[model samples]
Target chain A: MSTVKQAGGRPRESRVDHALAEAVRALLSEHGYASLTVDAVAARAGVSKAAIYRRYATKEEMTFAVLVHDLREEPPADTGSLRGDLTALAARIGDQIGRSAADVMTGLLADVRADAALGARFAATYLAVERSVIATLLDRAVTRGELPERPDSPVVHALLLGPLFTWPIVLGEDPDRIPKLAPVVARIVADALIAGALPPAAQDGLSGGS
Target chain B: MSTVKQAGGRPRESRVDHALAEAVRALLSEHGYASLTVDAVAARAGVSKAAIYRRYATKEEMTFAVLVHDLREEPPADTGSLRGDLTALAARIGDQIGRSAADVMTGLLADVRADAALGARFAATYLAVERSVIATLLDRAVTRGELPERPDSPVVHALLLGPLFTWPIVLGEDPDRIPKLAPVVARIVADALIAGALPPAAQDGLSGGS
Candidate 1:
């Protein structure tokens, strides 16, 4: 977690941090979030408990860091068209689905539901970052007149992601089904946009006391 | 879990069972799935550990049984039009959301993700039941010619429930919002239906090796 060690050419301090993060990811893949313990992380990483505690205040914080690291690795997709961008996003999301990510996500869902502060942090950090990416994509489409000027970004975001998110959790639905289904989902979303399902912005002067 | 005691007019066995189930629900609400133990449930229920063991084979089994009980209490939604039926279904789903149900569901997600057998059981017993309810509603719509002869029921079902399910899990979204958002979601779904977003059936001779 420190840059000084790497600058000094020692690399040991940074190695411990990387080891701890990798350990968290490995354990999450194997055991999921419920059974993960800090002590076990230290043992698996070959680091001391003090080292783990020095870096992260809580398990949730550590997990969030790992997720952020993973998120940064995903290149931003800009395909020039709303349909292409959304479909790319879907494929990116679909690529993220596997045993490990799904397991971590299932565990994260519980953590998010149980703790409000943690949930807010997740929303701000992970969810918001992704949403902004989508917003930017949609904004470009708006400039091209492919979308409304003030489309309901949040609703569109939900529509785009809801099925992908729900598929694994809901029984009998395949998480892998997203790739095949992304085009259809994107088409439906584009249709919603054209039909003006997006909420009217306040600046549109549509407000009333009704 | 046994009905024999009621037949004898003693009611002791049935009381123990009810107490155990209530204890499970309470503990689930209080501590979620990971922290709940059979011994703790026995202590909370004022029943013997052996009695608890006799009823359920494992913690997953017990939790699944509680979910099934809750599911049974939800009456099926049926209205004349597809829109009306979907809206009613959304309302019923919205009404079922609360602290306890959310807590239990959060716990179940962890369990289902961790254990394949338990996840499948949940899918089979709980998810399948709800799907059947949606299927029945959709079937009536099809009969009335409101829907095509061969519709993609799963996609329609996914569209109907995805947003509702995503809310309260993702930040800043409300489960209760589904009631208000139902019509909008149903409208998009209806549009998809007419636009033929649904995959055509194989019986229509569309299958090919291409």
Candidate 2:
């Protein structure tokens, strides 16, 4: 939502920013990350290069902005049970990985390798934002006491996000496998939390009961 | 180890292949995947460009050869319990991902996006090789009765390898968190196996004694 303010105190045109983002996304999809260029984005968006420079410090920043714009807003509140909340969250995450989002992500990896500065920005902006969202959901589960606090939130977050991103790369399969992954990961994490709270002996054979 | 034989009766020069692989690895570590070229590799290896081409039809093949050469050999065979086998396997995997191996893997991703033919070859040679190795190890576990026969061997393979690759990209941390990851995953999978075999009521709680 941040916009540049001109010297005359007028807000920069939101329409231009929107167009630039669309152009960037289109280029990212069509030409891929390796071929996308700021100049091309400016030409396609019909915005002056100077306007883009005024809005984003660098091409990497522009790409980061596009990703941020495309990312789904945080999961909606009031799904009720932890299972429902997670199922909804997983579905959204899966969708992002399923379509153009995966291409964008793969392109980002290429961009990151090509430019170290871009990689750092991507880590800070795109990855950090996603991690924070997952962490927030995990925190909610702990507060609700549907799960115990023992597996460490970040570990659980990694467990969930790790498989989501990795499936396509390692398995060479569709990201829609979230329907399968969500339940398996959710069950494992739930079991770990519940097991961690129990005595060692009691934890040994614990199974399906939540 | 399969190599296309020369039809004219002269055996292929093993040295050329070795030199090309070494050159490819060096170039990957230095210039990364984007900058690597078959010509540069041939030059660096002091081998004729024709010699390199005769060995590898493309740069992708040379790169794949380098990766397979760099991958640690199939894990050592042992009669140890499932926990020991998994722990050792995790450590070995961690070592590979921890060292320059991970950089090579990421570089491969960039190359895959740059060339479709290369991507297909890379996936078949590298990804397929890694999956086969993991599958072999897991099969040993099944034979030992530590794992139940699941028709989903491929899914389990992905679940394991996915996290290994995902951690570096998603968390931007050491992929060797395997020490922590191994036991947790092993425990979960082991429980899933037990759950598959046991009666419904027995599945709910973790009792220490049999």
Candidate 3:
């Protein structure tokens, strides 16, 4: 709230942002979201609480910013085919979202259901980004007539992420193994869409034959 | 442990089991998995701490027993086709795994990554059951020639569960809405497999075509 603008705002603000990001990542990895407090973050970053509060109103907002920022992949370059686009996008997500980011999210997911405010933030940040990535790919496919209609965005997004996201946990494999499977997972999900695997309602009356 | 059997063997065991179940459900529902304590459970259930220790070796064992016990659905009646069998099984699971089960597991999941013992327990119980159900259905399909081969059980299980399990959380829909989608979800997953959506690795070299 006070004046720190004497040194020129942009560079100083970036410096604080960098410090806060480092602190949030360290604290979240070490103690997880349950113990992340504004005070701890402030102390860890060596910044006054005012700086944190100025940037984020709550711990959820702070954690969300750092974790989700890592996932803010630029729109994948168009690859002229639905399968290619999905493969590129899924690979980018798999490559960018590291083990710590996944851990932070898994931790945050537990808290989301209990707190409506946190759930709202998660949907707006994480879910919104996933939907945008999905839209970019699906819109291109629809334009190319690869799909009769776009499937439900949420369902389609889950198809892309659910199996690949849980691959390590479910199989007890190393998380590092996911990179090899990224394109394969993308291919399967894309082929599923091409094969008419949308649930009946998701088909949205597109195919009434059933 | 000392002399509870004075009343009778079977009835006393049942009573203790019932009380422990109730206590676990209440504690998990109220405080999630992170805060569950043997002391709290024993106090709440009015059983000795030794009584709990006699039953389960650790908190993970206790939580896994109570939570996974709820999911011990009887093997679904064989419905005579892959789709029918999957639908029946999925519907049963949807009906049994209520919001609280989902919530408790979601909370436990964050910790599972951080704790290897808990991860082992989760896989032995929750994932084991899921694999068994998928195996039952897929084995039947393979026997009946509905499938060229059995797909990878873990990947197939994820296809069945990953979307439906996250439906409420991702859509922000009421958990009560899952039952309606259960059959539909089953159909889609079954169709996906039939249509050869398995990633090339999961296809197990059944099809030589690229």
The best candidate by DockQ is 1
Please report the TM-score between candidate 1 and the true structure: 0.74
TM-score between candidate 2 and the true structure: 0.74
Off by over 4 Å in 3: A1-12, A28-36, A44-46, A70-74, A96-98, A101-103, A169-172, A199-210, B1-11, B27-35, B68-74, B101-103, B170-172, B199-210
Pairs of residues at least 3 apart in sequence or in different chains that clash in candidate 1: none
lDDT by residue (tens digit), candidate 1, B118-137: 67766665676677777777
State the local distance difference test value for candidate 1.
0.65
lDDT of each: 0.65, 0.58, 0.67
Could you tell me every candidate's TM-score relative to the true structure? 0.74, 0.74, 0.78
Worst 10 residues of 1 chain A by lDDT: A201-210
Q: How many backbone clashes does candidate 3 have?
A: 0
> Which regions in candidate 2 have their CA more than 4 angstroms from the true location?
A1-14, A64-83, A101-103, A146-154, A176-180, A197-210, B1-21, B68-85, B101-103, B146-148, B175-210
Pairs with backbone N, CA or C atoms under 3 Å apart (clashes), candidate 3: none
- Per TM-score, the best of the predicted structures is 3
| DockQ head-to-head 1 vs 3, winner | 1
* DockQ of every predicted complex: 0.34, 0.24, 0.30
- Give the per-residue Cα lDDT of candidate 3 at B12: 79
Residue B137 in model 1: lDDT: 71
Per-residue CA lDDT of model 3 for A1-210, tens digit only, reads 111122334777878878988898898878877688999999999999988887776676677667654234456888999999989877765664435444465666667765777777667765677778787788888889998777666666666666565666433444565566567667877877776666423544322222
